[model samples]
Target: MDDKDRELMDRYVYQVVRRLPKDQRDDVSMELKELIGDMAEEKGSVREALVALGDPAEFAKKYAGESRYLIGPLYIDTYWKVLKIALMCVLIAVFSITLAQGIIERYEPGLFTDLGSIIGFFTHIFSTTLSSTISSALGVFATVTIVFMVMEHYKVDLDEGKNVVWTIDDLSKKEPGSKANVTGMSAEWTPDRLTPVPGKKAMLPRGDSIADIVFSVIFGAILIFTPYILGVVWFIEDDEIGKGVMTIPIFNLDKWNLILPVFLISLLAGLTDAILRVIIGRYNLKVMVSSIVSGFIQIVCWIIALKVLPIWNPNFGNELRRFIDSEFGAMDFATYFDPVRFSNIILVLAIFGLAVEMIVTVVRTLRYGLDEGKAR
Candidate 1:
């Protein structure tokens, strides 16, 4: 095959094998490449050869087995993986907040003497736990299912397929150190992969990178859109604040007027990066570019948090004062939650964490890209 045909074949193989199961990827890719090459040789055109194979997406389904399922075989693993993560996040956030509130507000060790009190106490506990756990789990299921459904519908590549391809050297029997020398289904099988040497465009996803993409998109969505849903659940009402539970939504959208626009732009950029990473299943130039944009946005958020964004609610200021006084008699604890100082401290932490992460990610990804970019 000429350089053009070889390049076309490489792209075609990538499209096919990336959607297949990892264990079957190498074998399928080699077989597909061989089939395509033979067709191209006979058809006298690489384009015609690919056309004969049909749409790469449809061709992938042939190897994938055309099962009539909502989520195909290719994405079941990812679906479960994402579902578990989302569920955990939701549960942890919901339960932690509610449980903390419940424990603090209703920490009565004395046995309930009256049947009415006993019934009421148990009912409250059951209601609180049931509401928090079930609601949060449902929300998570919806988010995870929606994301997976979109992926399945679009047939987004999620690294289920192997990242190997056939090379001309496979024709040579005794090529020392050649990747084709690797064995499959044998004692000599070294992962049974003939990994295509990394090139300018060859950026395979690392486990960490893919995970980062998944959680970032998931949590970012939750953070931006459903801020009200995730917060400190407060049931203990201060006499000053009046009767009823008060939720201190630290990331509340109602108060996130200015910060919302800027923060969401950053969030959206991160979400885009994550989705693109799933599609490419790698850290490439585009991914790196997105990271750079996201990093800058994170920095801006930190700055805003420090300068303008109130970490604590203004509405809660007077209530907090009364609550503190009631909980601990005659103790002035206003400075403990000085919004400016607290937010700045939080910003400091955020900036440091994001800076370190960005630096490490950029360096690792850039080195990989540079290594791939070397003249072959």
Candidate 2:
């Protein structure tokens, strides 16, 4: 109601307006100031005007809706929609591959048993790894596209008020190869005299060539090999079937020959995926290096497993003896350590690693993409 109260309201409006986008911020602030002034005049009291305008926080929220970065609202909305669809498509493709593998194993067991077996082993080894790679690539692509579209939609001028427009006469005044200016040598061409061009916003890294491909491949390979190496170490430490009686399946030692090839193929596939990502987009070298280190750490785990398992249980050695004897009987250690348990453990580890890698890759890709867009 009073001049004091109107001044307080003016301060409140100014604070709220400060948070808005710079391009339109001044206009919006001026409009708000004028609106408050008129409301105060009509209501006779600033408190009455404030009550009519509703809560200050709520008023701020209303204006907040107008604030956005270079990316317009429509583009952000569409980008998310398309991204979800693309992700769903990728998921469907993976599921279809899995289902096809299952069908081949079941219905045509005799027709392609050998081929099916080989395929099945590889499918298990690299399913999670491939999924992770695909997800990361998709995330990066989405980020880049969104950024590109935003830069296109909004003609964001970083220099804004600082841009200096030079006239034709100003350029002509500087003689063809003159050492000094036309201002009687008093005007020196210092660094400050030349207005700096605005720096471009950083954009997502783009892997547009062969070098990127190679980097991705190397990174992926390490990731794939790390787990298999761990598994091998686990196998070697508990080689005597009796030690893993409670965890392994009832298959001949000969059947395990399948695992070696599976591991190798998985390693190769992982390497390929990594290479593809590097080739297609930018990624952090640190992350790839860390993954390699993780693989080595996995080997150490295997060495630990070898030493620790036997010491943990006194019955470990005796269990092997019992398993050997029971082979002649109906009950055997092989039956105790079923294929399901072994597969489950391997799958769990693979899935965990895949998840971690995917998360890191996606986050990095998005950040790089956003930065690149800002630069542009």
Best candidate, TM-score = 1
User: Model 1: per-residue lDDT, tens digit, 124-181?
Assistant: 7768977978987998899778866776677764322221111111212222223322
Model 2 TM-score, 2 decimals: 0.29
Regions more than 4 Å wrong, model 1: 1-67, 101-123, 135-139, 146-291, 309-343, 366-376
Top model by lDDT, which number? 1
The lDDT values for all models are: 0.61, 0.44
Q: Alpha carbon lDDT of residue 101, candidate 2?
A: 33
Q: What TM-score would you give candidate 1 relative to the actual structure?
A: 0.47
Candidate 2, residue 70: CA error in Å? 10
lDDT of 2 by residue, 1-376 (tens): 4678868887777776766657867888788778878898999867777779876666766776644345555345434533553344334444444443333333322334487666765665467546765775577567657653654355333223121111111222222212223223444554434422222321223333233334334433333332222111121123454231132222222333443344444444444443333222334332344345444444344333333222122333344446556545644544353334454575567656765765666566455422321223
Write out the backbone clash pairs for model 1: none
Angstrom error at residue 256, model 1 = 5.0
Which consecutive 10 residues in model 1 have the weakest lDDT in total? 163-172
Error of 1 at 328 (Å): 5.4
